[model samples]
Target: MHDATEATTTPKSDDELKELVSLARLVAYARENARDLNAEFSAYCLDLAFGALIQDLDRSGVSLSHESGQDSSLFGTRH
Candidate 1:
């Protein structure tokens, strides 16, 4: 379970790097306005963020649900 060469591997891809940067920014933003983020506002933000993420996944050809599952109507149509 130890490989020295593996530790020296190349950096992450552009997409991965961008995702990290985005997460860092989001964290920093939340920290900057700690008190302003109340429970209701946080819940709204989470819903919007997750909805956008699901939409992006659909656009990228990723399906979140199957045709014969109980959670089929949870996400609605791909579009």
Candidate 2:
């Protein structure tokens, strides 16, 4: 039910292309690793990606709850 023209259309912007590439990589990784429903594996992959993002943000000096010593939005309180 999908259109061939739509499938062949280019991404609108660099941001869109990056998002697509990231999603494709995630999907490929999931397919290769998560053979079943594998909730634990999925959660591990999500956590790994999130930790990488946090590291990137930290390198860019983009603080979350780290400066305020408060609970993070996703992970809750830090030790």
Candidate 3:
């Protein structure tokens, strides 16, 4: 959930890296909590995360269709 337009003067500093590490730890904690939930709920969360990632890519003008060549359809007409 990072804003694309927000400009940063410098690259990730030591504190920023530390914050990223902390966020990773939190994600790990969430995974552990998910394991305690039902299988359906865990799968739902995984799917939701994937959908969010796809939406973000779309927002950034990343086309996932076969026409873009990055994702090729099995029966798509080739140029």
Candidate 4:
């Protein structure tokens, strides 16, 4: 049986809230696009990996503020 004496709480931080929203969106996208579980899982995993990397950079004082100013192409210049 489940415990009735415990109380539940919602996500308190922006990161936590974003994670929940990302999960919901991922599942919804998978269902709507008929994507395979493997593909969806891979995408979610990659997203988490990149997000953590960026967070770590920020914590280490390596700002990604210039990210938007950099070239978005495959290389320094567009093809």
Top lDDT hit: 2
Q: Which ten residues in a row have the lowest lDDT in candidate 2?
A: 70-79
Query: Each prediction's Cα lDDT score?
Result: 0.45, 0.46, 0.44, 0.42
If scored against the real structure, what TM-score would every candidate get?
0.36, 0.37, 0.40, 0.35
Model 3 agreement with the true structure over 8-72: per-residue lDDT tens digits: 32345567545544443344345445655656677567546544544443444443432343322
On residues 14-78, what C-alpha lDDT tens digit does candidate 1 reach at each position? Answer: 68545644543354344334435565666556545554544443444444432344222443322
Arrange candidates by lDDT, descending. Answer: 2, 1, 3, 4
Question: Number of clashes in every candidate structure?
Answer: 0, 0, 0, 0
Alpha-carbon runs more than 4 Å astray in model 4: 1-38, 65-79
Name the lDDT value of residue 15 in candidate 4.
Answer: 70
Per-residue lDDT for 1-79 in model 4, tens only? 5243321222135675455445434433443343344567666665565455444435444444325642122112211
Quality of model 4 by C-alpha lDDT: 0.42
Per-residue C-alpha lDDT of model 2 across residues 1-79, encoded as one tens digit per residue: 6374653453345565455445434543453355345677676775466555444334434443433532133233222
**Given candidate 4, what's the lDDT at residue 65?**
34
Off by over 4 Å in 2: 1-38, 65-79
CA shift of 49, model 1, Å: 0.5
Which portions of model 3 miss their true places by more than 4 Å?
A: 5-10, 42-79
